[model samples]
Target chain A: MASDGHPSRGLPRSIRNAGWYLLLSVLSVAVLYPVWMTIVRALSEPFVYINEGQPFLPVAIDWGVFNTAWAEGVMGRSMLLTLGVTAIITIAQLVTSMLAAYAFAYLRFPFKTVLFVLLIATLLLPIEVTLIANIRTIRELDWLNSIQGLSAPFLASAFGIFLLRQGFMGVPSELRDAARLDGFGHIAFLRKVALPVNRPIVGSFVLITALGAWNNYLWPRAAVTEQRWETIQVALRSISVSRPERFNVGVAAAIIASVPILVLLIVFQKQIIRGLTAGAVKG
Target chain B: MSLSASAPIQAPTRRRRSSRVREALLGYSLLAPAFIVLGVFGYYPLYRLVHFALYRPNRFGNGEVYVGPSNISSVLADEEFLDGLWISVKYLLYTVPTGLVIGMLLALLSHRRLRGIKVFQAIFSSTVATSVAVASVVFFGLVNPKIGKFGDVSFISLAKADSALRGVALTSIWQNVGLTFVIVLAGLQAVPDAVIEAARVDGFGPLRRLFRVTLPLISPTLLFLIVILMIFGFQSFAPMEILTHGGPAGATETLVFKIFQRRAPGQISEGSVMALGLFGLTFVVTLLQLTILNKRVHYGE
Candidate 1:
């Protein structure tokens, strides 16, 4: 509204608004156009699609291709396996990060500052840097082709600890003292007071972690040798590579793999955005 | 009564000392799980990575023979390694600036107080839902040169060796645009309204105000986005793997993809060296960014 009254602008307000709307609408369409085409490609018959010069809309719709992709790609099994791995990693991250954050926030300890710095320093050593050695470690542990290997390396996250610690620090010290006076121990105080107050942060962390685990690509490809253990991402790749003729089947598989996360994005849109921009934006 | 009164002072001191020790133990116990996981997975692998780079597996296949820094030296001298590094840098150049400009434009366009603007915001950020793998596949189909929407046109050939990296970069830019938009918009939203109003009152035109006032105000966010986009660009693997498979002449083989391809047992030592090289490059870039840009960034405080 403050910008609406600017004196330098020559265009009228209504006309300016209309221009903005038009530009935004065109951009939105450009962004969504590829995705819409993918859906059309997936549903249309290959022969009909090509004959029709790949029409913008599906002609001679074929819903059975989804079933074929689901079966051929083994998407159902991969989806379940991915969901399980995601659960393991997300829950472990939340638990370990909460404990670490609580200790950092409220508990007294030796080497507190040193440990915190060390933990944060791991941020520099991203998984990409350690990919080779980690694969070796997983092999040594005999965790290859196992869910444990897939999820083990990501069980704890330095970023999660830092974020949760920030959230926990926002809990007033007076409340902690009050909780202590009421015979609440460390765990009880965390459960009753700290966690409830930081629910939004926790929720954001959950969605972010789950999204990362579910969409993990490189590690899963390296860790699992068996088709049964392949995550949805790895499965999609194999389907695409193995069935070049049935490109639409691969597209169908990609769409299937994306639906769950897209639904999550739409439902928890705010939390996901906040989670992503957590440290980037200052209060 | 005299004994009870005398014990009060001594008992208080002893109890306080014990309670402090108890608190310290509790803290250590609470921190143990995260430390254990990080030590085994995060820190240990780093140590082993260095060790792997310095040693070659013995002929017996049972032990490793220390070869000093030969692996690192050879890896540096290798032409393929250099090509991969160059390609990664080229990718960074291609994706980061384009993504930044586009993301900034989208954020600025949508940062108005108009009716039903939330719908547009949602659409702008919707690309976040697509993972790198999904985006790559979608783009692969769209640019496949045969059945693609733009495949029939002859003016621009995406599947060719010269433009293959550009093709992968296009997919990456699209996938990452949502993240960039979100971060930049958050930064834009944080800019105080009074600052913009003051600029307008000072008779600054729209473009001039954006450059001088708004841009400086959000410089920190922009810098953060640059660092992140650079990292993503360097670490990019899926787009290359899916779209071109490092392409007609290894044009899109980033350092990470090269390292990934060397996962076999014999090549582990060499791969370790390359991985460390990637780490060194990332560290230098991040440090360079902070040192050079820190002076220019304007903190609100």
Candidate 2:
């Protein structure tokens, strides 16, 4: 089965391998073009491309755009803000979802099925539809100009709880019974037994949820009225859309904003890929 | 004496059952904080959406504000709202199929056991990490024509509505293609070699095999992707706000964009109605797709 090509007998496997490599190289170029262009623009003068009229490559390379973005807090301040917000949201969401999931998976309570189903139903409703009312609520709470407002509403995600509940249900019943017999309380059993065993799943959920929070634009934009508290995504938007004429500056800002996510993807590509596949597998 | 001892044993059993109930109640208590948050933020706003959409506050009395029949009529009657709906529908029509196609193409290309499949897969998927705003900005640079990478190309200006939509769609499709590929590739890998062998033995050609076997087997996955993609398409806002700004002439103003503008902190009446409209549109479309795809997809053993 490995070498059964009838008409391609004249062509060696080495030649075939070369052809595949060539095709892949062309693909690699196509995939990397946008990223390469972004880097080139980010490192160049603000109006160099505009002045040159048709510079495919940077005419004058400098770190001025990064400097500008950092000074403007688009890169430096917004990046830190986004990171902090993402971290807090991820941690809060994880803990909440894990605890709720443990209850659903292990505890026997009245109306358990009904409540769990109700929680899961929220997944079907588009959160965007509720944005207006949510904003109003946030304003009322005086959380309109703070990170607490930005992250609070979204910290209790039905999707996260659902995913973790499914993960928790896969644990054997005997393990829980054993922990119970050993005098572990419900919360203690969950933290010491269920959680430690499902580290991979917990890690996957954290990465995916963090990505969602990091990339979230609408809620943060709607809730955070103060410009100083802007996340990197919102900051990027302010730079790009608000200053449409400054093509180089806008592009530079975009490059700065995207680099962190790109770096994260590179570092966790394998886990990310696995996690993505896992979502599709059961569906 | 034995009967008396047996009768007494049941008392302890009942007490133990009560203790179990207490423990379970404790678990529920521990879970209360998260549930309260979910209820107020997640469930409450959804319920309020209907109320807000229906009742136009006395603050802005156009008497035409009640939700009963007038609000629905007003939503359907507004020309700008209709236009926004049209644009969003057009976007969905273009984006959903295009994403699936491009995803399938990329997945197929990289699915083979080749030296660079991993590298290509990684690069193709890099777009998944980019937010909508970032994608919009990158494409904005590309199609600037006056100062873009393709500035020399005559067809690059975003001033034209069609061109703007096309540009946004292209960037969107590029960013989304990676995730789609990753998703479909998972489905493809799950196809058993024995099934392919059997199909080959039955004298079915590659194309036939793909359509008849591979597609049917992966229908569940494809359906999931389609539903998710259409939902994402309807929710598209950043691209419009950042890339085209509803463009050359409100060509790319999606329903979500209108909802955003209306609900902009101060004016709540029109925005509430628009938000309700957007919600209805998404809900109906999602449910319709789910029902339609239900007949086609078969989750198998």
Candidate 3:
């Protein structure tokens, strides 16, 4: 469908294409405007984002708003807490999902189809539907305002099982048989053979889960009242809402909160997109 | 672990039966942890939803009393709940088409083979990296009329009683546009070349090809995106929670927000009822879209 590379292209077509390009450039700027303004205000003078007279271009820059924001708000601790929670959830989900995925993909069990359907059925049940119920469960377990509350409900991902099962099913049975003949039990085969063979899917799942856990706000908001248990996003929102005077610091906190995932995006661009589109296909 | 019990079960197909039992044992062991977690967090909530919806917690020192299905009507008749549902519909109307059109437009623009197109694509999809909470706060800060561009304009948040929802809806569109863009771009790329070539040979203009041949062929992707976006829009909470906090006088208090706001024992029944109502709405709409759209999608069959 793309036929514009050749020099034989007419001037009319070129001008039209240039028009499209300009529109795209302008729209991109508009799309990036909110983020740009936030980052500029964040790194620039504090509260300049709120002032009526502050220029679009920052006049004076304060590079330490991040430090100040982190120090003042529960941001630093929140970030560390979020990282810890994401790590716990990621590791727990990976292990559990991998095990379950192996069972679904390779093994035959009684009521296997029924169990699989039940798991997939949960995909339709968004957490919003069950937030109250889950909160009650967390309270009952005395896991509220703690790391377990933050990560327990997310320890098993139905999406992970579905994604990895596709990968495992792609594994040729001959290879599995050979590994089995070598006395590689399920765990042994999974680690040495299956995981390596399905590294991309595994990597994608890890990044997606990390991103989800890092960005989770609703559950954390519902389950945790203590500031000690707040994730960075939730903490940032509380700061912005309860204290609008600290808008700049809230922006700073946002910059800090998104930094790790931004780094991840830059590093693992293709894997993130793969994970996203995998979700689209599943939907 | 239960091999001893399995060993005692003699059958005509003894060998096959024994391996079946052993595999079942292994499978159950592997699945137990995930299943337990799912049961507690996933299925249990659904069960509790029905239970919670059927009872009303008394306002006095007394506990919850069985109210049968009355909670459903109470929740449905709640002024905030109804407003919330209305705002959610408005949100879906506002965000979905805007996002879909912007995404489709950008996809068509980027589908052209031009130099430095990847840079433009990256810029278009950059917002995909941001979380809902982050984007909401950024917009929240920027919506101040004093310094920020969006704030300078009165139409953003001060347009009317329902303007807060509009403001939050703008953020949702901004944040979710990248997702729609990426999905639609993939759809465009997957669009077969033969049809486009045939359209070109048939003397169709660029715009005509886009409106007729391309969009029709890519309607499946568009339909999938619409369904997902509808679900996202109906279920949107974090944006409203962070940006509007269910108001400038609760204008943006969508259903999820109402569900969240109703936390007291007196309101928990309504919350559960609203949650169940929303769950049913989302479930039905999703199934409806999938069934309706799947038949009409041009699969190049």
User: How much native contact recovery, as a fraction, does model 2 achieve?
Assistant: 0.44
Displacement of residue A198 (Cα, Å) in model 3 is 2.1
Please say which candidate is ahead in lDDT: 1 or 3. Answer: 1
Which candidate, 2 or 3, has the higher DockQ?
3
* CAPRI classification of candidate 2: acceptable
List the candidate numbers ranked by TM-score, top first: 1, 3, 2
Candidates' chain B TM-scores in the order shown: 0.89, 0.83, 0.88
lDDT of 1 by residue, A1-283 (tens): 2233464568887888898889899999988888998898899876775444678888878999999999988898999999999999999999999999888877766788899988877777788888888898999889999999999999999989988988888877667667766878666788899999999999999999999999888899888888888999988888875555678899999999999999999899999999988766677
CA shift at A62, candidate 2, in angstroms?
1.6
- What lDDT tens digits, residue by residue, belong to model 2 across residues B267-293? 565677777787777767667665644
**TM-scores of the models, in the given order?**
0.93, 0.90, 0.91
Cα lDDT of model 1 by residue, B100-194, tens digit: 99898889888878899899999989899998899988887777665667664443246687777877788889998899999999989998898
- Evaluated at residue B34, the lDDT of candidate 3 is 96
Candidate 2 stretches with Cα past 4 Å from truth are: A1-10, B1-12, B59-68, B150-157, B201-204, B285-298
DockQ of each: 0.49, 0.45, 0.50
Q: In model 3, where do residues sit more than 4 Å from their true spots?
A: A1-9, A12-21, A44-54, A174-184, A279-283, B1-14, B59-62, B145-148, B289-301
